[model samples]
Target: MEKEEIIYGAHSVIEALKSEKSIEKIILNKGQRNEFYEEITQLAKEQQVKVSFVPQVKFRKYENLNHQEIIAFTSPVKFADFETIIESILSKKESVLFLVLDGVTDVRNLGSIIRTAECTGVDAIILPKNNSAGVNKDTVKTSAGAIFKIPICKVDHVHDALFYFQSSGIQLIAATEKTDNYIYNQEVNAKVALVMGDENKGISNATLKQVDAKVKLPLLGSIESLNVSVACGAMLYEIVRRKTQ
Candidate 1:
């Protein structure tokens, strides 16, 4: 029983093999042979992605549909280069928008953020390659397939990406209750990256130190904190309203 997220269809798997997607493994039907078989095997070998051959009985779940005789269990989100995606976006849009996740380790939270980010026209999502939930089955499910719609940059450090964003003339706004500044007070009409931190710890002091501003959504409830996704959606929609209206 494979437990990872699966992407079937020869075109989909072939594109994944050609890109920088983290493909955990590929399974081929031993009884099936087609023109794409050689291409898929060669690309997988070149990318050093693991491939497995099994009987067609293993694909019983997908027998009713056209899976193109191939299955690829992969991290469906392809990571873009931090510098390259930034430069590319800046080249076209004078006012850009981005989201930064600081050690958000929950896959579902990450997915929800991705969904909101996509809906709000976020240029890309920056995440630390380490200590992050990243894309997975639950993430994809939570995002309602929005994971594939947005550009994601997996970098070595959150600080590095923040610094780069600043150098590129984009502002960094940290979303946290640590500050008195509210989301509505901040100006996100220009190029900016909204930074959200971990669920328990909030924004790290180290990360907060580098942000241009620290802002938070007003809380009237008894609780001091909100779920990361809900807070993020509120903040992003505020930005969207500012940018659009």
Candidate 2:
């Protein structure tokens, strides 16, 4: 990570948090309890920033510098405001085509999805603030710079975003293996949000409830399911095909 992408020292991290910077994660000395520790923890929680506690040995790389038992990594890309982007898309009277990700942590998969979404002309990609991969160097590279070209929105809770999209007349179509409905059989040409879930867990039951339709890709071979990225591509291209036809 670049020096500008990282904030070191307790005071610096606390200030960054106070300023509501887009911090990816914070690392602190494992057993060291300092005066600013509680304040940092509180601020991180309020900002929904992930905090990790590492051993003193882990700080050896910073031995030459004064890290003050704290380091925070800021996201390289600025996240978009979901509501603002949605409003703008609606104002243009354009059909909303959004890709909502739930608990997708792999940077490569996230990158591929972003690349595919951009190629597919998706309006925006929505992700939950927690448990989703942030736009970092690896993700950016994996996306072939598509991350910069697309509007990525991180929300506090994906379910809330689903609710808001539904209220705005965007049909929520969930891609899952648990459903009997197949994507080829569904109507996806209209304003819709395509939801892809965690690689292992699929869609959460609570989230599944909010979707207007749950569709799955048919697996006729030995493999039970396709990779998340490939499934996303198949689903998105299907939408493109439907719109064109």
lDDT of each: 0.85, 0.89
After superposition, candidate 1 runs with Cα above 4 Å error: 1-74
Model 2 agreement with the true structure over 1-245: per-residue lDDT tens digits: 22228889988989999999889888899889999889999999987888889998988887776889798888888888989988998889667689999989998999999999999999899999888876677888889989888888999999999999989989899999888998989987579999999988888999999999999999999988889999999999998888778
lDDT: worst 10-residue window of model 1: 1-10
- What are the C-alpha RMSDs, in order, of all predicted structures? 7.9, 1.9
Native-to-model Cα distance after best TM-score fit, residue 72 in candidate 1, in Å: 13
Q: What is the Cα-based lDDT of residue 27 in candidate 1?
A: 89
Best by TM-score: 2
Q: What TM-score, over all chains together, does every model reach? A: 0.72, 0.95
Q: Write the per-residue lDDT of candidate 1 for residues 150-241, one digit (tens) a residue.
A: 88887878998898888888889999888899888887748988999998888899999999999998889899889999999999889878
What does the lDDT read for residue 66 in candidate 1? 83
